[model samples]
Target: MTEFPEGIESGFAAARQIADAVLLEGYVLYPYRASAAKNRLRWQFGVLVPPEYTAQGGEHSHQRTECVMEARQDDRLAVELRFLRVQRRTVERATATGGFEPVERLELADRVLVEWDEAVEERIEILVPVEELMGEGVQQGFRLPGVGETELLREDGTAVGRLVRRREQVDGVVRLKAEELPGPYRAQRLTAVVENASTWIPRRRTPREEALPRALVSAHLLLGLEHGRFLSVTDPPEWARPAVERCRNEQTWPVLAGPDDGCKVILSSPIILEDHPKVAPESLGTLYDATEIDEILALRTAALTDEEKREARGTDARAGAVIDLAESMPPEVLERLHGAIRGLREISAGTPDGEQPWWDPGNDPAVDPERDEVLVDGHAVAAGSRVLLRPGRRRTDAQDLFLAGRTGVVEAVLHDVDGSVHLAVTVEDDPGADLWRAQGRFRYFQPDEVTPLEES
Candidate 1:
């Protein structure tokens, strides 16, 4: 373990929220119960298995990240590697001979313990000077020792069962290298490689489940800078574009992190994210799924039956926390998670106070959904335009297959936040067509998913 200066450590902490989200991205899925088939296959990203296992076409054994940064001779770099270590948990029952036998389930007065695998968080930190990395670079090796523990499941003083947990030893190395770019700017390319060097060799044809205990799960890096700033790999400045292009990143990508002030931190993650990614303030806590909607998962967890909730609580401590959090969330907090808007533009110059804001379509004179037009098959399609729905362009939803070749009357042309156009149509023969039109509830399809029926 290594410590960073106060200023540097605080900068690193700014990136911790999103970094932890990536670390435990899919630790558990919705429903949170261990019986769910999706829950059985955990550790979805950044898994570094033993080299021997990966040689047999198993999950990858390492991750590499490379990025460009502007630095000075006196600048210092701090690196932190975070990952999860899988821990095998087993339940045992006491037999007539006073010996404990491994069992799949151990029921007690209050709860039931089931045999399942859990993750234990692990972190390794290193701080080095920029000049040191410019030459021979820095190499740090780490190890997590194997250990086991047992807790007796007792009733009023007599032990009826026992819970045992074990963790396998894992060995790995973090190597950091930096090279000065040949451009006019004082920029350097930094490369970091995380490799799992565990000595446990797998037997021939061994399954991944058996080898997971000795692997480094969900490995990622957090880099902090002192007296210098890191350049954004996703959207670097024009001068640094050439240097960014030369950087080769394997199994992971790097993005600028921390506040919009100088870029003093960079997060190299296995999960892809745009520059300056921030965890939503509305999020209550860790739901173990960052890619999912918080309100939806919270509602689903609250809807689980009592028995299912009990089983989830017994699965792992984190899962139990999730259950408690969802069940006890206040109405105000749940309401906050419903929706949030960002990047609102400042009010236009000299606009009246009672006028609609800039985000509202009515604020713009040229914006009118009903009269907007889109070109499909070399013809302009607008309101009241007859078109044939050919919903096979992308086919994102299964319902699209059933809507193929259906005739529709275009009611509006909608534009999304991403600048893509969509046509809101009402099926020509649908019984609810008039009702849907009146209520403004129309089906939306991309321009490419419809063929215009207008004359040339």
Candidate 2:
């Protein structure tokens, strides 16, 4: 198996910068420090480790993470794991070896100065589910039914312990081989099966080299599915820096982020690297739509909530398209998709000026109208006419600032030299309304975005 690439170059300059920020956000310096807690929370994507695994200083002492991959029937997946190890420590003599060998008052352990030596290792595992590769109900890889025990071994190659099976438990009997997938799976998840992996080993100069085994630090994974490349943060090996950047410049980016669960191991949340450093992912409905997830969400939101409809973002013509397609989807799936969309908004919510040509509404000034007249939803409006305010469909700082369905009466109708019409609305609710800024302290809206109210 091979490693994955550092995915495609970012979509645009803004995207590229954002991608790099996500990668480096929580990353800490080598040997790791304690002052910053955010760095310690980083690199949680695609991590898979055994039950009860926890790191000594950071994540897991003997930890690993994985991605769930499924390739086209014609394609395959290549995997590789890379990391640095504290192989050995060089200890200097802490105390002088004087002629006398007696000293109850002095703690000799303080005399040794320890410096660690580092090394690198790589391991590979390839998986092809029986259901996908072979026919259904065919159990070729599984071992005969029997009880199996997890054995602990010492460096001397001797058994130190075994997890004894209980008298009356359904899962007490462990099979020599892991259970096979039930059947016909498009994607089969596989976790690492580590044996006797530990991060720290006690020094034993009195007898042996060390009392335990360990996993290395700053691990990197290069995984390639039949479709694209996948890799995580962590400085590249000195030899691959230029090559790595070259790869980054050519890669298409999709954010792979997760929650801050405060655990040693976590699964990644798929997102688009967004602007705004301080905003958390939970607030942004800025999820990346690569695998038709947006389509799925469109279908699910067909049944709208009263609150959703009240929010101007939900009233757009696009809302209807997502409904009929989603009626049968489960509520849980819809909830996660809702979270994804909310996360997506966090990016659009900010007011940042950059080379974002892809933005829905250009950041440039509004267009001048051809004629001056005041009309809302095709209804003629004059001073003292009460109406409802509909938020602008275009997502921008000005649009977001407007409240949806607000009740207000036209105080005056004004136009500019360009013949652009503005409705001067005085909202009963806004005591601070001023007739200065377009609609005074209230907001100005094009006649197209407001709903006209007749009498009461």
The best candidate by TM-score is: 1
C-alpha root-mean-square deviation, each candidate: 4.2, 22.7
lDDT of 2 by residue, 48-97 (tens): 22122333222333332332333344544333333322233222221344
TM-score of predicted model 1?
0.83
Q: How accurate locally, in lDDT, is each candidate?
A: 0.87, 0.34
Off by over 4 Å in 2: 1-20, 24-269, 273-371, 382-385, 390-405, 410-426, 435-449, 453-456
Cα RMSD, model 2: 22.7
lDDT value, residue 447 of candidate 1 = 91
Alpha carbon lDDT at 137, candidate 1: 91
C-alpha displacement of 219 in model 1, angstroms? 0.7
Error of 2 at 109 (Å): 30
